[model samples]
Target: MDEKRSVRISKTLSRVLRHDPASIGITLDEAGWVPVQTLLTALGRKGTRITRDELDHVVAVNNKKRFAYSEDGSAIRASQGHSVAVDLGLAAAVPPAVLYHGTTGAHLDAIFREGLRPMSRQDVHLSADTETAVRVGSRHGRPVVLTVDAAALHAAGHEFRISANGVWLTDAVPPGHLGRLAR
Candidate 1:
């Protein structure tokens, strides 16, 4: 495939894996993988197609490096989540802290923009428990759990953020977060 077309495929695959395609203007869901029909439709919109062999070629060309292959080789997934997945994942981690969220969806965008990205996802994930999962949840007047000490973030430092649903955006919170927070 041409470099331009290859780049498009990579972007399309990333959108499929991370944000819901429908949310970004595309519509596709093939049971954890984009269905061939949906792929065809998208390709058609872009004026392209694969004659089975071409599909195999694309899969063979990018497998494991830029994407993953299903057991039967009938499906594929982005290697991580996007073209810049590694960079995002490898950035400094967030610290244990109180994460806030909007009880209503209206404040979701603000929470993410102001709370999530800037903070490490490993320090918080997002949750619906206030006074508990602090790392994940939000602060938009919603109940959320504030993880007292996320091991990952604790090891990393005190830089963190919150998820849309109020969950801490951490890699993983320790099991005894409740006790840790109490202290």
Candidate 2:
């Protein structure tokens, strides 16, 4: 699959698997998994026919590693970035001393005042490294990377969980735990 087709499929998968399974008439289970065939059928019904080969290809080469197949290879789900309510089943783990968030300057004043809120998503998504944070932030506009005091937050009893794709997930980053990093 070309990058364009792969990306299109990925966005579709991200939508149904993460944010809107009901939009395609499929129901994700408690853990946000749906049988792979069911998803293909649902997409087909919606006139976005993606083949199994294309699906597998997109899942394999997605740059962000956004989707995952179940251990038994019968089902699939988004690794993170869900706006809908579905527990990812990630456990609290000690994060490194620092984490990073990427955002546009338009949100900086609010972010500096309110810290990082999840916004539309379930948990605030953070990158384990600055490069990834820059890429994430650039998606919105000119990127600004914010340094997170992960260790201090963890010590203070804030929970941290690493996603399957290495994104750090947390309920919120209070202003005290945030620091300006770079534009």
Candidate 1, residues 16-87: lDDT per residue as tens digits?
Answer: 544445543444333335555565566556555545555555556752244555677665554333322222
lDDT value for candidate 1? Answer: 0.43
Q: Residue-wise lDDT of candidate 2 within 23-47, one digit each (tens)?
A: 9899998888999999999999999
lDDT of 2 at 74: 88
Stretch of 10 with least lDDT, candidate 1 = 81-90
Which regions of candidate 1 are displaced past 4 Å? 23-31, 45-51, 82-183
TM-score between model 2 and native: 0.98
The per-residue C-alpha lDDT of model 2 at residue 146 equals 95
For each candidate, the alpha-carbon lDDT, in order, equals: 0.43, 0.92
